[model samples]
Target: MNTRCLVVCLAICAGPTFAQHIDIDPRKDVANLTGEQIYTQVCQGCHMPDAKGAVGAGRYPPLAGDVKLASGAYPAVMVMNGRGNMPAFGPMFTDAQIADVINYVRTHFGNAYTDSLEPDDVKVFRPPPPSNPPEKH
Candidate 1:
């Protein structure tokens, strides 16, 4: 077999194995990590290290110089509720983590937005937990 074919086979085989190694649980020790750390581990996969998003079958929308960051609430909502292909990090990250990443993205990557987001700010966007119905008599 040619080297190209062998490389392709190896890459395909590695995909699932690489994904399987990821920790799916969101409740890990993420609180102490910085926003840059959180973004590197989570958002950077799609948003890119530069935070200048990508496009394939879809546009990831560059976070750098994005006017949407003008309001801290906007990105917080997106992180929580998700938009388009971006998955919601609401369950995966603590409120502080969400705020950190939001603040990080807003301030870095050539973005000039100065507004800061606190965990309390993010909490506003989170959907209320479903209420349990009264037990049937």
Candidate 2:
């Protein structure tokens, strides 16, 4: 096959595959998702399928057997506020979802912490919205 034809064929074949794997949907409501569902659909993208995390341009900390998860509040705050390179999910996720996911991670992925976070607990960690709107420049 000619080079142009080969490129066209490859693009056609790969298009559907690429589209199928594009799981991140910012507009989709995830409020109803369970902890495991949240982790699989969202967190696994960075943390890896095994929850061992990854390192390349930036480091994604391993959630497996993490000591920080021992304190439910710590992870709850981190998820709400974010730290370092991690993006804040506070605006996107509901308190319930955050609590559920944190609880899930705490129990699974080599972690055995029995203490689970409640949605009310997560509410305390969320930063209050700005009282005044910023003026447009």
Candidate 3:
């Protein structure tokens, strides 16, 4: 096959894969951005622009007034560590960023939960330190 023809064929074959791919920004500084901005740029791809979630090959639960969000801790952990099909974003965002996004989701999309999370609150959910060998009692 000629190089030109091979390149064309590869492009045709790769088109669908690119179309189905969702781009999530890998930037680490989300603290300065508003919750809506973070959601629009990052979460919108999966959770959707409306924050209603989606279903197809996989299920994404809606964030609109979800009872699970009544506790800020639930969403904070999910955002930080990820759950099910969601990717872990803990390393990609600061505590303040995670808290801001969680707070946004909790308060928006018909969700009326009044609680707001702080960086300390998110820190508490982090995996605990490894325990030392128990001393003989």
Top of the candidates by lDDT: 2
Once superposed on the true structure, which residue ranges of model 2 sit more than 4 Å away at CA?
1-28, 133-137
Worst 10 residues of 1 by lDDT: 1-10
Q: Give the lDDT of residue 39 in candidate 3.
A: 79
Question: Each candidate's lDDT (Cα)?
Answer: 0.73, 0.76, 0.71
Q: Please report how far candidate 2 places residue 17 from its true position, in Å.
A: 20
> Model 1 off-target regions past 4 Å?
1-29
TM-score of 3: 0.70
Q: Which scores better on lDDT, 2 or 3?
A: 2
In model 2, the clashing pairs are none
lDDT of 2 by residue, 54-128 (tens): 886678889999998999999998889888766677876789999999999999999999987999999999888
Off by over 4 Å in 3: 1-31, 128-137
Superposed on all Cα atoms, model 3 deviates from the true structure by an RMSD in Å of 10.4
What would the per-residue lDDT of candidate 1 be over residues 1-137, giving only the tens digit for each residue? 22332332333335544333443222333446688887776677677778788776556778989998999999999989888777676876679989998999888999877778999999999999999999999
Candidate 3 per-residue lDDT, tens place, 11-129, comes to 33344453234232223233356777767766776677787888865677788868999999899889878887676767656788788889988889999988799999998777776
Give each model a TM-score: 0.78, 0.75, 0.70
Instruction: State which candidate has the highest TM-score.
Output: 1
Sort the predicted structures by lDDT, highest score first: 2, 1, 3
